[model samples]
Structure formats: C-alpha cells, structure tokens
Target: MMHVPPQAADARAKTGIPVLDERLRGGFPRPSTLLLFSDKPTEKRLFGENFAVQGVKAGDTSLYVDFFRAPQLARGELKRFGTIDPSKLVFVDATSSQLLLPSQEKYRISDIGSLTNIREAIVSAIEATAPSRIIVDSMEFLMDRFDKDDVLRLWHELIEAARANRAVICFLFINWTLLEEDLAQIRSMSDFVVEFQSSVRGGIVRNSMRISEMAENGIRTNWIPYAFKDLIGLTVYFPRILVTGPFNAGKSTVVRALAEKAISIDRMGTTVAFDYGNVNITGIEAEIFGTPGQERFEFIFKIFAREVSGVLLVIDATRPEELPRAKQMLDLVGPRIPYVVLANKSDLVGALSTEDIAHRMGLPSDVPVIPTVATESKGVRDALLLLAEMIIGVR
Candidate 1:
C-alpha cells in the first residue's frame, strides 16, 4: 500500500465563496465527506451547488446526483451561481421517474420505488466517472423511502468509494426524520458538518452558517452572517473594515463614501445599530461596517467585532480633546489587528495636522494617521487603500 499525504492548502477545492474558503483555510479536504444539515428552510442547496460548480470551474469533472430535482431544473438553478461547462458535469437522475421527465443524464434510475435502484445508480456513477467532486442534493428523498439501516449502509459504501477515488463529496440533508442515534451515526461518519439558519427581522431576512464540526482544524465558531447575489450564488462572506470614532466625527460619512450602495440603521440622524456598505475596489472585496460614535452604543461593539480584518478609526481633526475617546473605541476592536486612523474634517477651519492628531491620540510612530474630508471623499480612498494593504501585509 502506498501512503498519500493530506491535501495542501492550494490543492484543496475552492468553494467559490471567498470568506468561506478563508474559513476553510482553502476548502474541504480531498476524499472527505461533509454533511450539510439544516432544520430551517435555508439555502442549503446553494452551498452544495457552489461547491460542485467550483470544482467544475477548476477544470475538474463533477458529479451531481439529484433526488428531489430533475436534471434540467438542477442545471438551471446552478447557472445562477455561474456559467459552467456542461461536458464537465455528469448528473445521476433519480427523480426523472417521479418527475415524469425523460432521463438525459448519464445514469438513470428508472424505478425510484426501490432503494436498490438508487444505490446501484449512484454507486455505479461514482465508480465509472470517478469525478473530483460530488454533490447529492436532498438525501431526505432516500431516507424517507428506504429503511434507515439500508440507507446508512449505502452511505458508508459511497464514502468508501469517494475515499478510494480521492474525491470530495457533500450531502445536503434536511433534519426532519431519523432518530437522534441515527443522526449521530451519520455525523460520526462525516469529516465535516455545516448547518444553515435564517431569521426575519424588520421584515428582512438574514442568513448565516455555522461549522458545527470540521475534523481537519476542528473549528467551532459563531454563526457567520451571509447574503446572496442574483448571479453570484451564496456568499458566506464578511471581510469587515470597521470605521468607528467619537460622535459626529463623520464615521457614517466615510462609510457612505466608500460604499457603492449603503444603508444606515439610524434613529433621528444617529445610528442606533450600525451603517453597512459593500465595497469592491481594485480586486479587493470588503464590507465596511461603521459603528455608532456615541458612548451609549459602545456596548454594541462586541456584537460586530468578531473576525475583523482591519479598522479605519475616524475622528474629527478639529477636536483634539476627543482623541482619548477615539482611542478607547479602538481598544474595543482589540489589539494585533491592523488599523489606520482617519482625521476627518481636515478641510474645516483650525483643523489639526496629522502629526498633531497622532501625538494627541498617543499612537505609536508607525501607526498611520491620514487626513481626510469624508463628506467630499477627499483622501478617503487613500486611507482605505492603506488599510487594505496593511491587512494583506503589503504595507
């Protein structure tokens, strides 16, 4: 027997979602099985589809076994993620009989009534195609119809086949049936488990994902908020650059200027929650989150402070007395994260110089204090670029 080393970071499959890929270090390990379980009606299939499409985008063959959706319907939905080469994707159609659609896939299950047919169709495709990646959407279709023990046995065999082929496989399942013991068995057999959850607040939907189990790095983190774009599929992304400062220091102005489209959760011209905007500049994608300047909202800092990639501390250049308060706000973001100071209102009368501002804030000599007029976007892009470079270690 020949021994094989674990997949390297660059060699791991890219999930096509930058933040998720970053959280995964690169992507799921090759020949590993991941269970995407969710009780809520979240976009679970979007994640699985993105994973399969990413493999196809990498010039590798991918297999998609559909139990709930027909082959055409699945392909159509996947196109919303990105355009893929049709030749690279092989579909195992187990729903055609139930859907009353003619089977055009490479492998077809003429009779979905029998568990043996489902198992034979999937197993044969896995062996014959030996694809680099595989996705089975809605495993509930099988578990609902077949015996639990038989389904588990077939699942284990598929896992073995994936390991032999050195392919990454993902199963999307809704947590409705199956006893707790059987669920535990399924989880134990998987290398990773990702769960999706969603909520409605103020008539707006917010989606998030939690990595419940990852055998490689064993990461267990809080629910990471995410959103989806029309053609870009699912994004488990929030590379945040926090802009915080004293009251009326143009923090919101800076956020609005940097964002292509922005919204502020303000009450009576004061941000009660936060200001958010998405920015894409020079190939660097980021989300700018501006915190409220008043000390009353200081308690809310801990909520949005996790996984901060960088910071842009905005301050009024004319108010040197508020420098300490601004420094205190920066402390809330914690140390060791790269940060740059923005002396806003530099165009105003009697504004303090960058040197004066830095000295008053007691910042180290190496920390940058850039002057800016946030309302006019003057010198704002420079401050953002500096922070971006600092985050990437290019500065």
Candidate 2:
C-alpha cells in the first residue's frame, strides 16, 4: 500500500456523475488516488470506466489497463457508457499474453508473468501518453499471482507515475482473502475511497455506492441509490417521493414543474385528486406522487404517503392564513420522515420569506424552507435535490 501525498487544490478528473462531482467539491482532485473497494462481485468497475470516459470527453487521452478482460471485450463493454472518442481510449493489452498471442494495441504487456514487466508497461504508457485519467480494471489478478509486498510496491510506483503526469488514478479491487489490517492499510493509502453494494429481492437487484475522503475534514456520504441508463452512465435514484400540502398550494403545478410528463385526476378541473410522474434531472431519477390537500381526499394521501422515500410539502407563500391547514396535512403523513418545505407562490407580493415560514411552522434549523414559484419552475429542482440529499442521508 502507498500513502497518498498531499497536493495543492487543483483541477479535477470528474467522476462523470454530476451529483457525486458536485458533492466531491468538483470531482476527485487532480493527481489523486482512488480505491474502488467492495467485498463481493459488485458493479464497482462501472464507476471507474465512467470516470475514464468522462476524462476523454474533456479532451484528454486516457489509459485503461485491464487484467480480467481482453482489449476487444473491454472496448465493447465500455460502449455501454455511450459514444466516446475511441482514438482517445488507449489500452495496455495484458490479456493477450495469457492467450499467447501477439498484441495489436499501442502498449502490450508482453511478459505478464513478471511483475516488473507489468510495471514497466504501465509506467511507459503513463509517461508516453501523459494521460489525464488512468484505470486499473482489477488489481486482484496481480495481487493473487505476485508477492503481496511486490504488488504494493508496484502500486506505490503507479501512484507516483500518475501524479507526475497530473492524472487521477483509480484501482478497482474486490476483497478475496485480505485481512482486516491489510484492508485498513489499503483504505489509508488511497486519497479517496468509493464502495459499492448490491442486494437481491423478488428477482430484482438494487445497487448503491458510498464515498469517503481519507483526508482530515473530508466528507463521507451515505449509500446513494443509483441506476444505469442506455446512454446515461450513472444516475441517482429515488422511488415514491410524495408531494403533499394544503389545498390550492399548487401541488399539481409543483409536480408539473418537476416531472417530465405527469398524469393527474381532477374533478371539474379544480381540485386535483392525484398526480403521478417520473422526474429525471442532473443525473437523478425519481417517481413523484402528489396528494390532494382537501380532507375528503385524505384517503388518497393515506394510501401512498406512508412508504414514501421523501416528501415535498408545498405551501402557498402568499396565503399565510392556510399555514394551519398545511400543518395538519403534514401531520397526517407522520413525523420523522425526511421532507422539504416548498414556499410556493413566492413570486406573489404577499409571499413570506423562507425564514418567516420556517419559524411560523416550527421547523428545525436543519430542515430547509425553499421558496418556489412552481408555475415558472423556479426553485423547484433545488428543493427536490435538497430533499433527495436528505433522503440519501448526506451529512
């Protein structure tokens, strides 16, 4: 294992995830080391591949060193990240040697059996291309075959090589037989660590990731639920977010402002009985459910609001008199649920300030009271994002 030396704050090699990049204070710091560690066979490599491609999109040549898959297979798998500049993607063909075949790539690991040869091949690529991003698909292959001390020495050399070229290096490793002390050493050596996990239920699989910065005063995030799309690589996911508040607080408008397409049940085109829609923005995907504010439709709120991932409590900022009704509606959904208060109609003359609204509603300081003009789509996305962070348990 290698200790990540301190460097001045500089430009970053983004993770290609807008949500994570923003939280990372503009992505992984340049010339940094990242450890993608998992206990089992999780999709941790996907994040590394995404990070490499993002750098290519930024006009930097990238070096991808794979141990498990051949160059052709690796190229095909990377296409799932969408169209990339194939010319910018350089590969160090390590698999061809095991197959006892001549390689076609610019850099080939001719003698895969020797750790020194592997080191030379990788360092040669880094020094030659001066790539902005480098990824070692899986380190366990070499770790298992070579001496552990020798492998750690190579790890240190690679990190130093990447730093010399001003590149962000990522290593994907799945724990096989490492001891607790060894694992802790690996965690301490890296500048940043991103972990992946998966669970199966009823023939469905859910994936999530957690990020931690190893430096002092660094931020550690909760397990953020995510999914992969056809063209989009990584996106945060939130299912069953409830939108409920007092009647005429413009819940429908809030839903409409947030959702791409929405379906609502209305009586006489007046009071909305229900609203349901899917929202995707800034690399986040969510299913939103809106509930009518009237007491008669209380049954509807009862049906869908209990198991919600989060809540968007919309209230008319101009109609302070309806604050009590809004409080009652919020109470119906129960307490201790992660919710965001949206001061809708904030553009109106009589609209109240976010502070005043929060004070009047007796909300805690940690609870955000965002002012929004749903009709104009103002402040809506911010409120949802804040609520999503809260639901994801971001500290």
lDDT by candidate, in order shown: 0.80, 0.87
lDDT of 2 at 235: 83
Model 1 pairs in collision: none
Instruction: Quote the RMSD, in angstroms, for model 2.
Output: 3.5
lDDT of 1 by residue, 282-325 (tens): 43467889999888787777677776878899999998889999
lDDT of 1 at 229: 65
Q: Point to the candidate with the largest TM-score.
A: 2
Model 1 residue 329 CA deviation (Å) reads 6.3
Worst 10 residues of 1 by lDDT: 1-10
Q: What is the TM-score of each candidate against the true structure?
A: 0.71, 0.90
lDDT of 2 by residue, 1-395 (tens): 22333445678777777777887778888878999999989988888888888888888778999988899999998888889899899999999999998889989899999999999999998888888889998998988898888888899899999988778899999889888998888888799999999986457788888888899978788788788877668888876799999888999999999998999998886555789899999888998999888888899889887667789999999988889888887787788678999999999997999999998988889999998989999999999999988876663
lDDT of 2 at 375: 95
Point out where model 2 deviates above 4 Å.
1-9, 201-203, 270-273, 295-299, 321-325, 328-336, 392-395
